[model samples]
Target: MATSPLQTPISTRRAAILQRTGEALEARLEAERERIGLWLPVALGAGIAAWFALPAHAHWIGLLLALAAGLLFGLLVGWHSRLGRSLFVGSGAAAAGILLIWTRALWVAAPVLAAPVTTSFSAIVERVEPLPARGQVRILALPQRRSDLPPRVRLTLRAGQAAGLAEGETIGVRTRLMPPPTASLPGGYDFAQRAWFDGIGAVGTILGEVSRVPGKEAAAPPLRTRLSAHIQGEVEGSAGGIAAALVTGDRGAISEADEEAMRRSGLAHLLSISGLHVTAVVGFAMLLAMRLLALNRRLALAGLVLPLAAAAGALAGGGYTWLAGAEVPTLRSFIAALLVLVAFLMGREALTLRLVAAGALIVLIWRPEALVGPSFQLSFAAVTAIIALHEGPPMQRFLARRDEPWLFRLGRGIAGLLITGLVVEVALAPIALFHFHKAGLYGALANVVAIPLTTFVIMPAEALALLFDSVGLGAPFWWVAEQALRALIALAHGVANAPGAVATMPNFPPWGFAFAVFGGLWILLWRTRWRYAGAVPLAIGMAALLAAPRPDLLVTGDGRHIAAALPDGGYALLRDRAGDYVRDTVAEAAGVDAPLLALAELGHVECNRDFCRWAQGEGSARRIILASHGRDRIEGADMAAACAAADVVISDRWLPHECVGRWITIDRDSLAETGGLAIYLGEAPEAVAALRAGDAHPWRLPQQLSGNDEAVPKAALAR
Candidate 1:
């Protein structure tokens, strides 16, 4: 008979409890041990991130990194606890990642254009990507006879100017070229770094019609261009562009409206030629090869179909990857697909976190710089999430799909697809928000239909079309594919237009992003009760991201646009006449969807020919002085009065020191150094009162400050 708790000896009860606790601890350790190596990629990525995070101007960073390397090396070789050893391995991997990226950066570094220029130049067109809807063509050309210029320049030609130009052809043009641009705002995409890596020094726009010599013989155009032209010629409207993107990885012909719709609907991944596309292509090729080989009785008896199928899959994946331009994401997907094919050959389960981890490791080793990109993160995260979901006990049983009725099996398939879509969407949400400041709210729902449509209907039709097109009998299949694309594009636009489809927010704090990533990895990589603990940090990160304060005012690097938060819940621009690039950048950073209002039209400011003063805050707590009209130089007494009366003075022109404002004085000199400034009012958080565009790197050195390059005041830089 079992004794009651009160009747049992205290020592025995304590012993039982302690034994159970020990068992649990051991189980937890075992679970961690099972997948600890998977964290190697994460560690490597962290190292890459650390390298990017450190200021390039910091001379001691190298020494700091050396110390870290020594510590990690010691931990890696030393005998330690299992958890401790795993942690050390991760650290060592990170060190390796840092070194890899450093080497890659130096290897790919190329000369960049320092300033804008206008010249008449002859160039050999290496590539010509047409933009039919926009009546333009973008060409990547090797400029001739100019050693000072970069190896290549990307240029755009308007309708008339682009006539008769093709890849591998030579043409002359008079154009104004600009150095590749830095981020328009802090943490935005930097085109200059990408340009430097791609060996593009400048981007240009033709001033007039291009000068093409008469009867000039040139090499044939690239296969990709001809393929795109052929597909577009056969298919009409936007479907042709979609077909081209799917087939040749060229989206230049896709209409801007349709592209934006895809982005909003979260269907843009379809055009990216990643895992979905590669897997579909590989799977079809394997199935086809297996079926054809199985027709032979000897081959079937020998069971060679499976082996041949694996080979075919591998070949198909590699060929498609190359054909699709082999970008980082595509390469990562291809690696994963190849692993899947290998799994088939070895008779092992293909969908597993190990597969994801291995693919990630290969990619990080090959392209360490890609660690910072949204594509790499999204592709890996989505695949990992799906695999983790399948690894769960419930999913394992559900996916077994025993001998059931056809209807029930179909229902299970639908349910599985929906579940996977939701899981992928959840996995990608934080990544999307972190990089893009936006997330698709209904992306999963849209993809539920879109993915199957593309995989089972559209892609198969396209394949059949391509096969039959050699015999000129592909019209029927092409028509079917075109109809499917119409449905897909319609779905994209419809979902994008739905209410609350896209969620936008202010640029969240980097620390919050770090927390989210850590939490996500913890949850996805482990299979123990402790993994749920990750949700706490994840929730906290989401809170911080959603609740972060918005800035009250923003000043562009050039001091050409100054935007302020309006009392009624939008932003008012100092100048609305400027191009949409700056306007859109400011809007995105501000995290508002409303169009910027013209400050002058707001009718709240009192203005003179020299300046305009907007009284803000309780009892005019903050008076903002905005320089106006063609005047910047102010007489001593007048400037002193202006400064004393206003709390903040913002001007693109030089402001004298004697006329310092009551609070902050911002001028062209300060703007030149700061790049851009986002100022927060109210009870400013410890370090969030003002944020700058951050320190410059090699390709993004600060522009020169005009009118006495004197250092900005300490008070101005303090926040």
Candidate 2:
């Protein structure tokens, strides 16, 4: 087994090269050890947030597991000098911190859980805003007599119901209070949890007319509410709504069509008070401060310019956070901006994963429930992707070259924007599909044009207008802001109307989302060639998303409506002109755009009053009937024949025992427990139903889950 001299030398060199590569990888990891370790808390925080989604009885198990891990990590940290276990200690601290915060969230939600539901209440109108409908309005009121409930409650009023009502005015309203909604489907959106975090105990519609009541308190509205009303009055029409949203986060004023256009064109982020708006405010304040400092010789010479500028930026960001209601996304952005300003003062780069982690940690600590929101997902995903691209190997190699001149900085800036837009679009696409079941076709191009306009033109004008209003000289500034907003809205409409502006995709499964999230985090956090391995999960996630299947039948959360997909590819509504939100949700889940209005354009869906039935052939799985009437109306000979003919029957009425035959029937009892059901057409009647989990979570009262025997499922008995 003797080898030739040439072969031996080549083998030796190959071995040396492999050794060098391994050393280099280790060195890179060592360099980033602290930064990578900073995210230990972030991961723990996410785990804690997810813990709330579990069944109520399962919480003790999670708490025990958390404690075990914390104890284990602490032990490891005790042997730190020998094992380099500082990162372990940090992770343990993070896990403990999150556990405490989760407990706090439950405690905060307790009073609301204990609140009683009543039909009449007297309250002070804390705030009021126009709803999307012509004459509807949303009121945020403070309950005066209900000591057990949370202080704030939200109510919807019909047209002319609150004609003369204003914020801070006491009013007597007769309304039936209802709990915040549970998930529409199993693992779906949980409005109950969101309401818990928002401090809203109940939601209701005002009955009849609202009557004025005498109150001793002042009738002046909060500063932010008054500002929003003033902006709406001055700006006029949809543009005014846009202005109000930019300044006060009152997006309810925007019409449905305009809002849809913005969403389709990927410009909807402009309406939210997020990273872009916060950064603009901070940048403007920083610039103004730097300029002001330059005029002072003593301060400028004392190296105080950067520090002063950072202080000003912090003040502006804090002010904007308050004005925007300190919502989850806005608060996340403010924390990040504050971190960046601090980095700038410390002579370090602001764009780093550590800063993002710090911001996320703070936000999760305050409101762990935010982890489930689209805003939190979208904001964090976009920022992480952009930062990864900036710090990637390719970008580093490009920056290593020193031949470029300063005059080309503008071109480089433009190129950077294009790259960032592309990166962010790609990163956020999977998340959008998982959440909304659609992706904007022109999002990248739209962002390229809209981002700069929003950042430099619209937001700045709005900020200036807000500033001017404080001095009673806001009219001219508002006019300028309106012009900018008009241009932006027009651009959104134009882009949205373009051919193939949005692509409807089937909703990705939870497993697919997990893969994508982990893959992206791996690529961003790891500093070695091993990071490339993340692409494996990324590709798998994309494939899963593309291959996901759509359900054949969809039932609304209230069980008041249902839709069945026809063999010919159109969706038929169970009721005419009702359940608009439900219809749209089902359509999105089915990977169809505009289910209600565009259903005709895509395919035909016949509607009627009593029932909507669809059948492909004489098979049990192919025939489906949804009845809206009661048993008395549907149990007649004609109705019995029709019901007996179908293999699947869904009704809001009670079905007789004799009626249960070789078929699957969902009636009042079933619908009462299961919020909704998604049925997939198959030979065996395969389907999934979403039921209200009878559990002891903070949002679910023990009494509500205890006495609901009808919520249990029962298999059919053979005759």
Candidate 3:
């Protein structure tokens, strides 16, 4: 064995290399096993939850049948290794879950089929479109129809009359009832799905005669609403309207400039009834209750007093946690509070993971649709990450060091804010890209300042204002509250407008969302020294998002102008004439910023007219025209003439006449353009050329408009 020294060295080197490789392989296998172990139970629980939460119309029998089949399949798999047996169980549960899901889908479709004939209805206006434009109204109707109404609700109207309608106003309207619109892209906002879950069968505007129902008042505002309103009024009376919104999240009074400041500063969420606001209110209430209880046995009545007081605080603070429209973060706070109350009464430990999981399970069972909502995803991600980071040995030890100074505390808070923001953003980035196609670059910076202010200042002040109002000394407190609100609004607007505040993203598939979420969960749940392994899916998700294809055009509707299209797959902004703030809206909804930049960089020539035209040469093929006219005509030429031989036509209004060739409408277009195969966006000339260049059958044009008697244009040919 020791024949030569050189042989011995070579043998040792080979042994070392083999040992290292084997260790790596073993480690990978262990990770996979751990992952499966953790996920299997969660998946089974989810499956069971899904099964039990099926709606009334779901096919219970079908699901049971599927369960039976899955059980048999599981038994077959169980004949193999123990791991296979566990997997088989999980698979059986998953099969039942899938069956239930399918049943639910069928159930949802039943109403559409059974009740094909839709009825019209009239209702009072509860909330107007937050942003301005003509006739975009969010009305609550009584499920009745009226004669002499527009077939389709008219969203756009002339300025003055349309803007006059206010929240809490009753109005008569006739509308065609239908489901909410489905998402056009994967991972997109399923407005229809949300509406289905919310029980909104159809949504439309007012028509026919305008009549007011006297004495038929709106549903008495919730207790919180009344208190909030009272506080807002008091604040406006003393400080101003702008001041009121900053304190109370009632932005109806704030000035445009202040609003803009808050947005630019990334503090806009402070003004809204979100997690920050709710958590602050809850924490304050808890502290007050604890202090009051410590006074004496006589004052420390535990039965219902404390709970009642907390409930009152919740209600006064706009039912911060109980708001139907609240996002997942706020809901989590509410559930956590409920759990704490329960634990306090039952003499159990406080704030345990099991309690959190129970609360989450309850929510998921109640509203399965929320599983896909941004608020739910982001909130859970942040909470999970925080828990993981806190539990880590190094962080735990660091925090245990009591010698840390006030500066350290402050620094820690800031760091926590940034970390939380980054975690939530990473979890949500995929969906954001898939949905809005943009990212808030300064979201973390904005949160660092705004979050603390919201928790420590604005919300607390608002709560105080409400208390003062209840105590009959409302005026002084209201004034202070309003002033605080104004300040908050100013902060948000400032943050929103800051340079490099937002970055536009490319659209991605829904699967990207699944990957991102899985990666996040893996990182948060894994207990290992090499935590970076969790970044694999996160990285892939981001890469997938970056590589997503850009839309040929972006169309935006402020619920008024049918839609605004932007060339180069960027954003388009629809003007809000009434000056209502547009939240989380993107410019890309109107037009593509990247292509617009590219055009500028390439020194494309510009043409002056109602239609702003950019061109390089006659045959260069990249032609973009921004049609700005309201009437849909320019210099004796209709949209058809203006768009003739054009590759892409971006317009503010819809045009029916430009369906003859490969024209991409910017905003509005007739059904013909959307349904007809003759026109397409020229945004990617290469793709268009490829389609035309091939010796293949062209896209078939419709013989007639679907459901319409109109014939298809003979000259129209799809390429």
How do all models score by TM-score?
A: 0.88, 0.84, 0.66
Instruction: Give the local distance difference test score of model 3.
Output: 0.48
Ranking by TM-score: 1, 2, 3
Per-model clash counts, in order, read 0, 0, 49
> Candidate 2 residues 1-719, lDDT tens each?
89998999999999999778756655665666666565665566645654554555566466657756766755654543312244355446545655665686667653453333545556878777766435688888886655544577789997588765678787777665666676675445668777776777777787777767534444556767677778878788778888888877878668878888999999888889899888988999999999999899999999998899999999988998999888888989999998898788788999898888888878877777677678988999898888878888787665454567886766776677787788888888888887888888788888888888878877787778777888988778778888888888898999999989888875577777878877877777777677888899988888888886667777766666666665566566655566556666777767777554332222333335565555533455465553553324544545566667766777777665545423677777877667677777766665565654565566666223111112111111000
CA lDDT, every model vs. true structure: 0.78, 0.71, 0.48
Tens digits of per-residue lDDT for model 3, 202-288: 444334434445555445554434444555446543234434434334455455565445544444444455445555666677667
Could you tell which candidate, 1 or 3, scores higher by lDDT? 1
For model 1, give the 10-residue run with minimal summed lDDT.
Answer: 703-712
lDDT of 1 by residue, 1-719 (tens): 88777866887889899778756755676768878888888888887887776656352267446647766665654445554465566667777777777778778766666667777667788878788868888889887755666668899888677766777676777677778876655556667767756777789898777766566755566677788888888887788899988988888778878987999899999989899999998989999999999999999999898998889888999988887778898899889988888887788998889999999999988888788789899989999998899899998789785999999999898888888888898888888877777788898899989999999999899889988999999999999999999999999999999999988888777778888888888898988889898898888788888997767777776667888888777998887686777777888777776788887776887667677778654433454555443465677676888787777777877877777876777787877666567776554312122223544354555231112123223332221
Best candidate, lDDT: 1
- lDDT agreement of model 1 with the native: 0.78
- Model 2 global lDDT (CA atoms, 0 to 1): 0.71
Q: 128 in model 3: Cα distance from truth in Å?
A: 8.8
